[model samples]
Target: MSKIIQSFEAKELKKRPFIIKIADRLTSFFGSISFLILNLLFFVSWIIFNKFDQFPFPMLTMIVSLEAIFLTIIMLVSQQRQAHIATIREELDMQVNKYSEREITKVLNLLKIIAEKQDIKLDDKELDEMLNELELGYIERKLEEQLSEKQKLIIDLSPLNKS
Candidate 1:
């Protein structure tokens, strides 16, 4: 299962464009503690070495501002790429869950048959429900309706919403 997931992730990575790959690498590097320490050291060194008469070094500020802008853009691109991968992963998980549910249902049906063949009297109401085919769309709709109602209740109960 781990190998399968690794292979899936590798395939996803391979499908990304060259530029996105670079951005991902940059994002990893930039998000590291090492990058933070390096930036801190660089800023401290710049301030110490430069004998500027001005209080707020314009050049340093400009350089930092430009770096911030570029890094922000890089981070946004990385976030977009991550969001896409997350969406793909979510879809894959949903498929796996559906497949598992079907397999489990089949197993339960087989167990019920085996129990009857062995002359074992097992009366389970839940088993009857388990044997029935799931209407996924109806279940999803019901779940959404329940969640929406709960969300509305939560919003209404919030202190911010109170007069």
Candidate 2:
């Protein structure tokens, strides 16, 4: 977990322009409850003052629509950054898992050899099978197929079970 945090911190340290940093901070703040309250207060004050025809405030509606458009753009930019980070994390995790699997296989083989040298009989068929090398490509392909099948089932059922 510490390693993961360090990796994420390192990733965040990459150089970004001042405007982008400001935009990121702004978007992050925009998602908070405080921002919601701020907007609520603004709307209430506007109504109390009769700022633009109390009940059917067309100006307020227009302002909100414009704000929505800009917010959507900001959200898209942030999501793109997040998706890039997710891809990097996924690749890192895959590499670590592959390395760990190889190391485990090496250790298991060494233990088996040591047991044999000591004249110790180890007769676990499952352990012997595990000692064999993993076929990562085949496993990955199978996993992808399973995921696609599950996605298809979800897509097929979603409309019929709509809330």
Highest TM-score against the true fold, candidate: 2
lDDT of 1 by residue, 16-69 (tens): 899998999999999999999999999998888878725588988999999999
Cα misplacement distance, residue 69 of candidate 2 (Å): 1.7
Score candidate 2 by lDDT: 0.84
lDDT of 2 by residue, 26-111 (tens): 88999999999999999898878874466788888888999999999988877777687778778888888888888999999999
Error of 2 at 147 (Å): 1.4
- Could you list the CA RMSD of all candidates, in the order they appear? 2.7, 2.8
The candidate 2 region of ten consecutive residues with least summed lDDT is: 9-18
Please identify model 2 stretches exceeding 4 Å from their true place. 4-8, 158-163
* Number of colliding residue pairs in model 1: 0
